[model samples]
Target: MARLLDLRQLDLEQIDAVHGRGTSWLYPLAAAMSGATAGIVISGGQLATATSAGAAAAPSGAAIAGAFVSDAALVLGLASRSVGHISLLYGYDPEEPAEKLFILSVVNAGTAASASAKTAALSDISRLTQSLVRGKTWEVLDRSVISQVSKQFSKAFGKRLTKQGLGKVVPAVGVLVGFTLNWTTLESIVDVADVEYRRRFLIEKYPHLANEEIPETFSDDLSDDADEAISVLNELAEAGGPDLR
Candidate 1:
């Protein structure tokens, strides 16, 4: 089975960084840069310089440095969008650490909302009263969580790289595979991050509405029929038997 990474496992530094850049223009800039750097990471600046299988060997020196920079920007861009989306749904104060912690807790709880749920909650804050941070406290990000997340990322990338086997030796095919994996992974991360953040933001902002009872809605026709049936049964019981004419 492929190992999965939990957004909650992200350290406080990363969380804070995203919060800080939630509304900055840098995210759009990074998206533009990634379009170019992504190719560099796959071809290692030697796309056509070598045709042998060995040309696609593990990166070293400049290639390693290039890949590192490119990937970091990609991840930052992804995080920025996630935080920005939350901000759009429920305003956040970058200056508030408690709010950030609540966001982290929501990520930990993995409380994702569907499109209909999101629309309903956005329409009415009271509908999003469930709290993920209630009765929960967190002081620091655990090292084990970080380690587990790292392992999951490594395993995912390893599987992708190894799956192509000899085909990856071709720079063209490698670029296609690398780009596809990156795009798919980004989409998955965005889906989880967006939904969870929206969920937490609503609950945190509407704490007063927490635990509010929701009245169940039933069909009026069914209710009337049930009431009439019960009334008839009561009359019969009161008379000790059904009257027969």
Candidate 2:
């Protein structure tokens, strides 16, 4: 079982450290893009070369073989990229205090931002991007959403891989295909991180948003595990969890 994050135990210094670590989002974005491109380009080039060598494979057979090779390369690339990203976002030791603190902070901040947006009926892009909600307290962490983070990333990467695979079908188009694949893959990851961090920063900056209020369940799709986690977080809040200020 994955251990739950308990934010109440975090000291002020640890919170500061986590906030400071948000610098240079480009590092992870570039790393994921480059790692994925390396495998895909190499695979594409090899596939082209093999086809040119006049291998005695049927048309459909060659297509199937090419897909398998491309998929294998993409999977390997995603796996390699995930290791570094997981370490950066979730911490070197996931079960450690700092790691737990960072996870909880990200979850709570994101949950708070989403709920605030809905409650205020603020659907305008500028409202979401520019306006800050004052005096709204933190919400219970929505485990359903947080649990889907890995799945969402995988889905995004898979789509990019598929697009790149299609490009490789033309043969000898490895370099251009890899460039397109990398750009799309990194953009998806960076966009989510950018919005989440911006909300977190806004919440931290405004004094009124830091206060703890009564915690309420926000999601109708919550699992039994999610309910249990929310209860624990609410209990922590009642016990005087760390304030954003």
Candidate 3:
């Protein structure tokens, strides 16, 4: 239990350090491009890469929507890689089967669900995390459960894609809109991971309250940083102009 608690604290510290350092060049590059004179060239190239082979035959709007989803996935993948590092710090071997199962359990906990349903799932995952930390063998997740979680995640992703797609409709603002949407999506994915892990951390540390609800409030430290990052990205978007790039 002490080991679990220490690992949790270490995870939080590592996350803060990474965000504070801001080592990724993507955000800054995206911000700088907001005011680039070559906005059309850059946006066009991005759209072309994001779309399928039949992109030329598709309507311009469809192509742009596809680009937004593609870009969003790429951004989420980057965030996942960062979380993968934290998984290692938690003493999970990224390459081993048991550790992979542990990682998947945490990842699936973040899938979109109704408020009540999500709360219940979080509680269940908190328990599972405790078992894992205590060195219990990992039980395979039910196929039906996996399917349900996948469907929920897909639904959530679709909703976000639709919302961001709307912003891409206006040609003149497409570049800035794309950057903002991608940044926001990335932040959201990271937030969900943070919440999921933090919940498990709390449950492991406070076994007395293990049966009680672990509120989202417990994860506010990470969420606050996510909010700040989103604000910074938005400010950068607002500062950049098509003429400047």
Candidate 4:
């Protein structure tokens, strides 16, 4: 008998598009393997080149630089708090600090920018929303079938995904995550759609990380400290790798 292979074909470009220009497999990859934030730190420039076998996308140096800026905005916007080995105090400003990060100590949301804000929070995510809105007629893209699927496909695949069909899925994920995230990033999961894919997979595979048992902090929570949420991701490659998975 022959074994069936669940082959998923993903392109470097598609991956980069979904994860945004400068996404990396580290944080998302770390979140999948380790946690959202991990004991990982690299230069703003190095992030664009880093990617793991698990990566669904790969990025370029330009994208890596984009990630740095994006993540910085998220950290300050979402105001994330301490999770895993990564603290909310970290933020990379290559232009200012030469890639050295500073922790935000206290995390807050509605009041002041601290270390608790997450991507789900409207304010936190909005930090990037305007720029994106101006760049494209988002209204038009939002109507595309790709965007449609991005909004609907929640956690249906895994790191063991095919890079092929994502032409539709990735954009959908991007549009949905990008759009919904702007409202309140932490309102849902990090990869709100991808996590759903893993959550369902975990329930079937390990059956240990239960819906209620899994640490809620790792799953979903908003923060006034949006910056904390954006720190680690600011410098990653926006291409194929475990990060997007």
* Per-residue lDDT of model 1, residues 1-245, tens digit only: 12122334444355455554333344434443453355455454355456545644545557644554455445434543555455433444422333432332222122112333223223222211232246333333244433343344333333322332223234555555445444433443344445455445434556553455433221112221111111211222233322211
Candidate 4 per-residue C-alpha lDDT over 1-245 given as tens digits, one digit per residue, 9 for 90 to 100: 12111111233244334443112223333222211111011121233234433233333445533433443344333322221112111111212211111112112122122334333232222222222223323222222432233222211111101111122123214333333323332222233323332333334334344424443233332243333322221221121111211
Q: lDDT tens digits, residues 26-137, model 2?
A: 4334534553454354455556457664443323545545554555355434433432344344223434332333333322222222344223221221222222234233
Instruction: Order the candidate numbers by TM-score, best to worst.
Output: 3, 1, 2, 4
TM-score of 2: 0.36
For model 1, give the 10-residue run with minimal summed lDDT. Answer: 224-233
Displacement of residue 168 (Cα, Å) in model 4 is 34
Better of 1 and 4 by TM-score: 1
lDDT (tens digit, per residue) of candidate 3 on 1-245: 34533545555556455444242344434432432322343355445555645545334555545555555454434544645555555434454433433343343333323444344335445545556556664334344434444344444444534453455544456556656655544444445555665555555556565566555542212221111111111121233311101
Cα error of candidate 4 at position 40, Å: 25
Which lDDT value does model 3 have at 208? Answer: 67
Q: Give per-model TM-scores.
A: 0.39, 0.36, 0.50, 0.19
Tally clashing residue pairs in candidate 4. 73
Q: What is the C-alpha lDDT of each candidate?
A: 0.38, 0.38, 0.44, 0.26
lDDT of 1 at 236: 22
